[model samples]
Target: EAGVAQSPRYKIIEKRQSVAFWCNPISGHATLYWYQQILGQGPKLLIQFQNNGVVDDSQLPKDRFSAERLKGVDSTLKIQPAKLEDSAVYLCASSLATGWAIYFGEGSWLTVV
Candidate 1:
């Protein structure tokens, strides 16, 4: 099966800087999510989208992070004024819908200095 695709597999930025990551989910998936995995920690759901509408974003830090799935096929996550503690692997995942098996991309790694 085809897998999720993400760009700029790795990034290094100074604190207070900004960065963005893009993702393309497998075809036909209607549910998409963005997760943050700090070093040595499990991934935490940052936001979720069902088609072009947002399903959940309670865990996302609106003050610094933002995400959108405009057409529902591709998505982007952005962080502004990134902090050192924000360093982590940003994972993009997709599934048929809620409760379905999820497939993850290789992840975009962020290192804030």
Candidate 2:
């Protein structure tokens, strides 16, 4: 089965630094999501997009984090002035439809000192 594609499998930075993660969803998929996973906890949905339009982003920290899915296909997530608590795994996911089986890419690990 085809899955989402993500770049920079891992990243390390100090507090107050900035980083960006990229993602390419499966072809023909219409729903994309970005999730943050902390140690020992389930993934937390940060943003969701449908056909390049944001469907949900209430959990995203707008002050220091931002994401975009252009042309309803590729996406990017950026965090500026990251904090220690922000160290976590960023997951990219996509699916043909909501409520269906969603496939996830290998998470991007972020570590902030």
Candidate 3:
């Protein structure tokens, strides 16, 4: 089976700019997640989608970050007015269901100057 796929593998922008990333999860997976991994830190959950419904987004910085999984197939994550601290690797992951074995994408790297 194919693993999760992410696009725009690298991006660079000035502070306060906007950027977006896309993800396509493994086939047959029912759960999708977006995570942020800052340098030297573990991945932090940003948002989670169970099918086309949002499951959790408490950790997402809604002020500037937003995500959606429409049709329960693909997802997109966007950060408007991006901040310097937002520079990191955005990871996309998927699983058969909650608590099931998860697979991850290569990640979209972001750099905010």
Which candidate leads in lDDT? 3
**Candidate 3 lDDT tens digits, 1-113:** 78899999999999999999999999999999999999999999999999999999999999999999889999999999999999999999999999999999999999999
The order by descending lDDT is 3, 1, 2
lDDT for each of the candidates? 0.96, 0.95, 0.97
Whole-model alpha-carbon lDDT for candidate 3:
0.97
Comparing 2 and 3 on lDDT, the stronger one: 3
| lDDT tens per residue, model 2, 1-113 | 56789989999999999999999999999999999999999999999999899999999999999999888899999999899999999999998878778999998999999
For model 1, the stretches where C-alpha displacement exceeds 4 angstroms are none
Best by TM-score: 3
Model 2 CA lDDT for position 2: 67
Root-mean-square deviation of every model: 0.7, 0.9, 0.5
Give the least accurate 10-residue stretch of model 2, judged by summed lDDT: 1-10
Q: Candidate 1 lDDT, tens digit per residue, 1-113?
A: 78999988999999999999999999999999999999899999999999989999999999999998999899999999899999999999999998899999999999999
Q: Decide which is better by lDDT, 1 or 3.
A: 3
Per-prediction TM-score to the true structure, in the order listed: 0.97, 0.96, 0.98
What's model 2's overall lDDT?
0.95
